[model samples]
Target: MDTSAIEALPWCADLSLNSANIWTVQQGRCAIGVVLLVEKSASVALIRKARVEGYEFSDRLALPGGLVRGVCGPSFAPCFEQSIRARAEEEAGLTAEQLSELAIAAPEFAPVSRYTVKCVERFAAVFTVRANIKRPQKLISADKSIQEAFFSPLPPKWEELAPANRLILARAMRDHAGDNVKTAARASVNEALAFCNDAAATVNVPPVPDPWMSPEA
Candidate 1:
């Protein structure tokens, strides 16, 4: 992972409460979910690649996702739906139509740690699709950040993923297993959008400084 490149992205600005606390809040990255839309009968998207930096897990599996800007919008469903489609296409070479046919699976609020950063609170939206099309012959990281993409069975090995991603995958799997995939996915998306609208309504909310923490010390 290129720390500099990640930091330079425009979205990085939102990671911090203020400029002075960037590193401390790196884990507070952003929320973006990519559920591998799979047919009800088929339940996994598996891949192989090198773990983090030096470690290697030739047959590793994970859903596609990452931090996103413009996602905290008027509605979380559309934003999440759009982001998921975009990331899948961009990262795994999957298309939107290919995503919609399968059962939409998503993650409820869960905590995950990326690198040393911890997303203290997070949520995701998942969708499923069935494709007779062959999986990519060779997984290629479109963004260079991703290693590969493929499909496998659900309840993937949690210990295999980065801490943050592990939390996400675990929650998604748990939801899928609980028979709450559809309802939870919809609820999460709706809640996200509603939260966004409420927050937007308070755009003019007074910025009262905490007595212990001054804006200008």
Candidate 2:
């Protein structure tokens, strides 16, 4: 992950949906990916289980996000934000009202993919929210978009998160820190990179399959 890129996240420009501006490449091309940094009771929310097939990240633990398409069903907020919020709702079953209460931070970009991964220009944005949202139950009777939705404290256990999500999680925490957001951000960034390095140094082995999946509708 590029620390410089994380530090210089560009504020999402306000674009009107009425305009025919092409945010994504084309109708069936690469889709922009958006993620959220939702904090509840001093713990950050994390989701596991990717449904895509053959992708390196497929079926692995990851952040709550997906491809952004358009306005999330007639909301007054910017379409970009709505797309992210809708991804959260679709994947984690969060509500629009809950998303509205979130304080979104500047968005960060990354190369990402969807189920089939036809495009590689997917941009990932992180929204930071300091509120009281409960972790969804992890049973089949609960939310569908993820296998499990749980909260983890800061300095998160690096081994538990997917490679990509761990970096963004650190970036979001740093961006949302107190008056010393910069210092906090630097520390978190270092920790994230160090973990990445350590993981790379370790012995390679196939990851165990996780049972979490999108629940039946």
Candidate 3:
């Protein structure tokens, strides 16, 4: 199992959803997540998932997303920005116009980071987008399934997040840390990832399938 995180996944843009949330491409399940980070204060806008039964990452801090849902033809070229914008609007109380205004070009988002959570059998791609929000703390969840939406300090206590998200946040916050702190944080994340990979190797747990699907909101 390859535990190293990469900037892009081969199937990241190959997945898509119809209005009904079924996989339009039938390529299998993979999730895409966004890290809406406020640059000035080093905070990230995250939604707290509602305490729902049978839901992974229940009541945990996570990105604004569920399954990939959008209109796409056989080509399946819906960009990551589509889902990122959709989730930001639906769950984080942002409007399409607002998010659209934030984007200037193709790579409005930060580097992509792909990961897998062995315990949940989840494969996901998480992208970080820098934002400039004056009152980030006032943000609220627009979706009922989410408990609340607020700006969490980057690298928020890892215990408060789900497994894959822990690595995502770690990578995002590492950029804001001092050189010494950055090195330490990176080492910590690599060790954690190594541990997960070794455990998966022993258990023969399928790490990441050829394709991926569904994320949390």
Each candidate: what lDDT?
0.39, 0.45, 0.49
**Candidate 1 residue lDDT tens string, 119-147:** 23433221222233343343345655566
Model 3 vs truth, CA RMSD: 8.8
Model 3 lDDT, full chain set:
0.49
By the lDDT metric, which is better: model 1 or model 3? 3
Candidate 2 TM-score, C-alpha based: 0.52
Q: Provide the TM-score for each candidate, comma-separated.
A: 0.44, 0.52, 0.60
Error of 1 at 188 (Å): 26
Q: 1 or 2: which has the higher TM-score?
A: 2
lDDT of 2 by residue, 1-217 (tens): 1123332333222322333232332332323345666665566666767466555455565666654445544332355566556666666666665544554443322322323236532222222332335444331214453667666666565555655466665555543555554443454445445544443223121111111111241
How much is the lDDT of residue 49 in candidate 2? 71
- Give the alpha carbon lDDT tens digit for every residue of 53-81 in model 3: 76666797776654434434333235444
Compared with the true structure, the alpha-carbon lDDT of candidate 1 equals 0.39
* Top candidate (TM-score): 3
Off by over 4 Å in 3: 1-35, 72-79, 100-123, 129-137, 179-217
Kindly report which residue stretches of model 1 are placed more than 4 angstroms away from their true locations once superposed.
1-43, 47-61, 71-76, 101-107, 116-141, 167-217
